[model samples]
Structures are given as structure tokens and as C-alpha cells.
Target: MSIEDRKQKIIAEFSMFDDWMDKYNLLIEMGKSLPVIDPHHKTKSNLISGCQSRVWLQARYENNRVYFTANSDAVITKGIVSLLIRVFNGLPPKEIIEADTAFLDKIGLKEHLSPTRSNGLTSMIKQMKLYALAFKTKHDSDKKED
Candidate 1:
């Protein structure tokens, strides 16, 4: 599905809950479903620096798309990254980099988060976009050489 479709689905899911606690429970449930990150990628290189909790993310470029796998020591952070991966995974690098991410605001997630967690969330998005940029650059260069 397209990122917008995925985002809308999430928005609909969140709308079903009338309280933030319910959202937290939903996030925890989502966290439980996050795939375990490869032990090899759980290194300093993949650690997102700004998060209060440790988050490790790795991206690979294949067939002109960027695939991501990640882990976070904090459950809520894990869910946050999982959501991002859902939107970004299997998408072309340029599309990943260009995604607007307004769904985050539409769902009221950003304002509802604690300031530190919100910062961490922003950092996570930045890191993902950086990875997409790197992949896009490499792919563009390869095309130039072709």
C-alpha cells in the first residue's frame, strides 16, 4: 500500500480510541509485533543519538527501494519506529525521502508525546530520511554511470 493509505489506516485506528491511555496500549501492542533486529546491526553505527532510549536502525537498498529494520530499548519507541518502517519499507528511496509525514500531526501523536519523546521521534524521522538520501544518491550515481 502507499504511504498515505498506511497513514490513513493508522489514523482510523487511533480514532477508535477516545483516550490517550488506549493509544498507549495500542502502541505497546504494536511494539510487541516489531521484528527483532539483527544482532549484527545492533551496533553504535546504527544507534540514534538523540533518543533517551537506545534505538538502532539499519537500512538496505534493494531493487531501487529502501528496506529498514530497527529496535528500541523502550517499547513506545519501538512502536514509533515500527510505524515509520511500515510507511518507508519497500518504497523507492526518493519517495521515502519525500513523504510529508503530516499523518503524525493528524493523529495528534506529536503534541501528545512528552517533549523528550517527541524529540526522539523527530530524530528517528531525520535518521530515516538520511538513510533514504544516501540510498538515493548511490542509486542516482549508478544510473549516471550506466
Candidate 2:
């Protein structure tokens, strides 16, 4: 599905919750559904700075798409990353880099988060885009060489 489709689905899901408590519960459940990240990739290099919790994110480019695996020590953070991964995973590097993040505000996720968590979320998005940029650059270079 497209990123817009995924965002709309998440918005619909969040719309079901009348209260922040219920939304938070849903977030916890989403966190539970995140696939476990490989321990080997949980290195200092993969760690995202500025997060109150330890969040490790690893990205790989395969078949012209970028795939991400991430883990966070905090449950809410884990859920937030999982949501991002859901939108971004398996997408072309250019697509990921160009995707708009307004859906986050539309889902009321940014406003609901604490200041630190919000910063962490921003950092996570930045890091993911940076990885996409790197992959896009490499991919473009490879094409030129071909």
C-alpha cells in the first residue's frame, strides 16, 4: 500500500479512541507487535541520540528499497518507531526521503507526546531519512557506473 493509505489507516485506527488513555493503550499494543530487532545490530552506531530512551535503528538497502529495524527501551518509543517503520519500510530510498510527515500531525501523535519523546521522534525520522539519502546516493552512483 502507499504511504498515504497507511497513514489514513492509522488515522482511522486512532479515531476509534475517544480518550488519550485508550490511544496510549493502542500504542502499547502496537509496540508489542513490532518485530524483534537483531541483537547484533543494536550497536552504538545504530543508536539514536537525543532520545530519553535508548533507540537503536538500522537500515539496509536491498532490491532498490530501504528496510529498517529498530528497538527502543521505552515502550511508547518502540511503538512510535514501529509506526514509522510501517510507513517507510520496503520503500524506495527516494520515496522515503521525499515523503511528507504531515500525517504524524494528522494522527495527533506529535501533540500527544512529551517534549523529550517528541524530540526523539523527530530524531528518529531524521535518522531514517539520512539512511535513505545515503542509499539513494549509493544507488545513483551505481547506476551511473552501469
Candidate 3:
């Protein structure tokens, strides 16, 4: 599905909760459901800087798609990253690069986070885009060479 559609689905899901605490519990559940990253990928290279919690993100480009795996030391932080990965994973690099993340505001995720966690969320998004940019550049270059 398109990023917009997936984002809308997330918004709808979040809207189901009238209470922020319940939403937070949902986040924790989502975090628990996030796939565990390979221990090998839990290195400094995959670690995102500026997060109040330790977050490790890894991406691979395959057949024009970017697959991301991530983990966080904090459950809430992990949940945030899982949400990001759910929106971003298994898509072409250009799609990921161009996605509008305003749905974050729509779901009140940004307002709900602590200042430090908010910064961490921004950093996670930045890194995901950076990976996509790299894959896009490589794809463009490969096309030009053909």
C-alpha cells in the first residue's frame, strides 16, 4: 500500500483510543511486536545519535526496496521506531524519501512524547531518509550506467 494509506491506517488506529494512557499502552504492545534486530546489527554503525534512549536502526536495499530493522533500549522508544519502520519498510527508496510524516502530528504522537524522545523520533526519521537517499543515488547511478 502507499505511504499515505498506511499513515492513514495508523492515524485511524490511534484514533480508536480516547485516552492517551491507553494509546501509550498500545505503543508498548506495538513495541513488543516489533521484530528483533539481529544481534550482529546492534553495533555502533546502526545506532542513532541524539536519542534519549539507545536506538539501533539498520537498512538494506534489495530489488529497489529498502528494508529496515530497528531496536531501542526503551519500550516507548522501540514503539516509536516500530511505527516508523512499519510506514517505511518494504518500499522503494524514492517513496520513502518523499513521504510526508505529518501524520505524526495527526496522531498526536509528537505532542505525546517527551522533548528528548521527540528529538529521538526526528533523528530516527532523518536516518531512515538518509538511507533511502543513499539507495536512490545508487539506483540512479546504476540506471545511468545501463
RMSD of each: 1.8, 1.7, 1.7
TM-score of each candidate structure, all chains considered together: 0.93, 0.93, 0.93
Task: Kindly report the root-mean-square deviation of model 2 from the true structure over all alpha carbons.
Answer: 1.7
Off by more than 4 A, model 3: 112-118
lDDT string for model 2 (1-146, tens) is 98889889999998898888898888878888776679999999999998888999999899999999999999988988998898999999988999988787766686634456436888888899999999999989999999
Give the better candidate number (1 or 2) by lDDT: 2
| Ten residues in sequence with the least summed lDDT for candidate 3 | 110-119
Error of 1 at 92 (Å): 0.5
* lDDT of candidates 1 onward, in order: 0.85, 0.87, 0.88
What's the TM for model 2?
0.93
1 against 3, candidate with superior lDDT? 3
Which lDDT tens digits does candidate 3 get at residues 36-133? 78999999989999887899999999988999988998999899899999999899999998988888887878663445643688888989999999
Clash pairs, model 3 backbone: none
Among these predictions, the greatest lDDT belongs to 3
Q: Count of backbone clashes for each model?
A: 0, 0, 0
lDDT tens per residue, model 1, 17-119: 9898998788878878776689999999999988888999998888988889899989988988888887788999888889988788766587624456435
